[model samples]
Target chain A: MAITSDLRNVPLIGQAIQRLCSLAALSDIESHQIALCVVEAVNNAIVHAYDREAQHEVQVIFAQYSDRLIVQICDAGHAMDPKHLAPQTASPLDFDPCCLERIPERGLGLAIIRTTMDEVAYTTSHGKNILTLTRFLKSCQPGSARPEE
Target chain B: MQLDQRKAGDALIVTPLEDRLDARVATDFKERMIELIASGNTIIVLDLSKVEFIDSSGLGAIVSSLKRMGGRGELVVCGLRETTMTLFKLTRMDRVFQVFDSEQQAVSALSGNKG
Candidate 1:
């Protein structure tokens, strides 16, 4: 479903995320992480996806499978050029530290979302920018430690 | 959602900030406080009575604003809701900030303190 960019929309998004997380039976930390990711993603769609002069709706889809929780945030503003959305990387030692401090708040939203979710993907199709985030429900179990690569 | 501001002596008393102080509204909050500080109003009281939530970004913004005010001024927060207070405690920011139970209390505490 789609919602306007009002603050009230946050609770609806939270509810939707909670339902999916419960269905996946995620741990408290996992659910909290997913909720944080959803909040940042939705906020970005509301503030950055559309130009202020125009009205736009953000579409959210929650899909739960046997092993994963999938969330898709789609906006029909200007299609995001995938190349322009590179993940933020740590500064190299040679780079000026002051430059990092001056970076605008917009860049941190995507980084926070990526760091909180297990899997993240972005694509643009037919003038729609779809950002998908996935959390593998199974990997979080106590005994299911990381397998040898 | 609710905001209250008043003046006690030379200090500005801001109280009962309701709603989540999250990334969505941190900028506006920071700007308002910073503007007040820049207007030569140093002693400030932030009454977070109704605030129910705050995240890391929100906490960071508040700390950054406090730093901006420098050692010459004081920024004190009061009446933090239980959940909001928990965040401060977890981040150990409660140690860094002087918190009070009411605006009057904060004003009284910082009244004599000056740079």
Candidate 2:
């Protein structure tokens, strides 16, 4: 799916992703997690890469494997900082729960993607930044979306 | 984003009428929340019953509202969908906000604190 980098168009992408995840027989919660991760990836691309400019193009590619699901968000805008693709150890969620001031109000998109997906990778080539998110299937239903046992 | 706000004793309940709370409305939501807090609403019960999806941006708005309170008041949550609850748990916000099963319970809890 391709979008015009408008933040308002993001929720539809999440719904589409959830529907595709359903084809793989993912649980509602798992699907929600994957969809959210993809949404965050796209949001980051739009907000950071394109600077939230609505005219820019942001494309999302979804592929299902026998044991995992892969999503790739491709954008021709500015290349994202590779550090965001790295597995984050320190999280915004780690702050003191008692101190409201200590809690972070932003910078959680990367952490959510890192925690939900099994692996996240980033590569930039030919002016396109591709962020790949992978989530291994827990148990694929024996059907068209996966290999039958 | 439309919010249904009402008062119950000393607590103010704010419910987002929209099903999804993503980046599109996070800023607006945060602004509205800050305005409400500035208007001297001490205890806020964010009723998310109508909201089905909440991304980091939306969650951040709520956390920002809590910070706006600045320890001078209270902020709580209620009526979280299962997936929404997962997001809270993933972010460890479940530890930060007192969550109740119903709006009544949340209001009661806040009232109890005041009493």
Candidate 3:
């Protein structure tokens, strides 16, 4: 399913993500996490990839396998460097709330996507910025805490 | 997004009458908070008992509102669900803002501190 790069249409995408994950037999918590990750991905495409330009289209595709689910968000916008998609080295444990100079205001969308999804891959193909997020259903038990290790 | 605003002792308690605080309503929430703060309601307690889901944008807005308050004002939140609490913890925002279990408890804590 494809959606415009508009924040207003995000709820509809979220609803579709939830329904698709649920149909794949994922638990409520698992479905919710996946949906949130998708939202982050879509938001990033709109804000970063397309620069919040109007008339741009963001395509979303959901594929469910026996053991995993894959969600791909594609946008025909500015290319994102693959190196930038790597997770940041900064751990939340190292974050100091009082250190106003060090606190990061932006990039939480990428952080949330990286933290929630099992595997996140980003690339630009044929002038399309593609972000693929995969979740292994069997490996991650429903309602289980985040794998800190 | 309707905000239920009322006075509790010396502080203002504002609750969002919505189930999810995501990208759609984040800006509205932040704007409303700024308006309240501008109206001299510095000591504020945000009641989130009815909110079940909050995205990063919503969290960012709340943090922005806190920054807007600066040192002269206080912005405390209460009645967060486990998922919402987890977001704050993961983002290390739990240390930035004081969170309570109940609205009354938050009001008393802030009121007591002021008194």
- For model 2, the DockQ equals 0.87
Better of 1 and 2 by lDDT: 2
* Candidate maximizing DockQ: 2
Instruction: In candidate 3, list every pair of residues with a backbone clash.
Output: none
lDDT of 1 at A127: 86
Clashes of each: 1, 0, 0
User: TM-scores for all candidates?
Assistant: 0.65, 0.95, 0.86
DockQ of each: 0.17, 0.87, 0.47
Arranged by TM-score, best first: 2, 3, 1
Single out the weakest 10-residue window by summed lDDT for candidate 1 chain A: A91-100
Q: Tens digit of lDDT per residue, candidate 1, span B1-115?
A: 3457788888888753656777667777777777778888788888777665565556666776676777677888888866567556544567667888887778878865642
Kindly report which residue stretches of model 3 are placed more than 4 angstroms away from their true locations once superposed. Answer: A87-94, A100-102, A139-149
Give the winner by lDDT: 1 or 3: 3
Q: Which model, 2 or 3, shows the larger DockQ?
A: 2
Candidate 3, A22-59: lDDT as tens digits:
87778877787788888888887787788877678988
lDDT of 2 by residue, A1-149 (tens): 88889998888789999989887789889999999999999899989999999988889889888778889999999998787555554766678887767887889998888888998899999999999898988775443443211
Residue A104 in model 1: shift from native, Å?
6.9
True contacts kept of 2: 0.84
- Pairs of residues clashing in candidate 1: B1-B18
- Residue A41's lDDT in candidate 1: 75
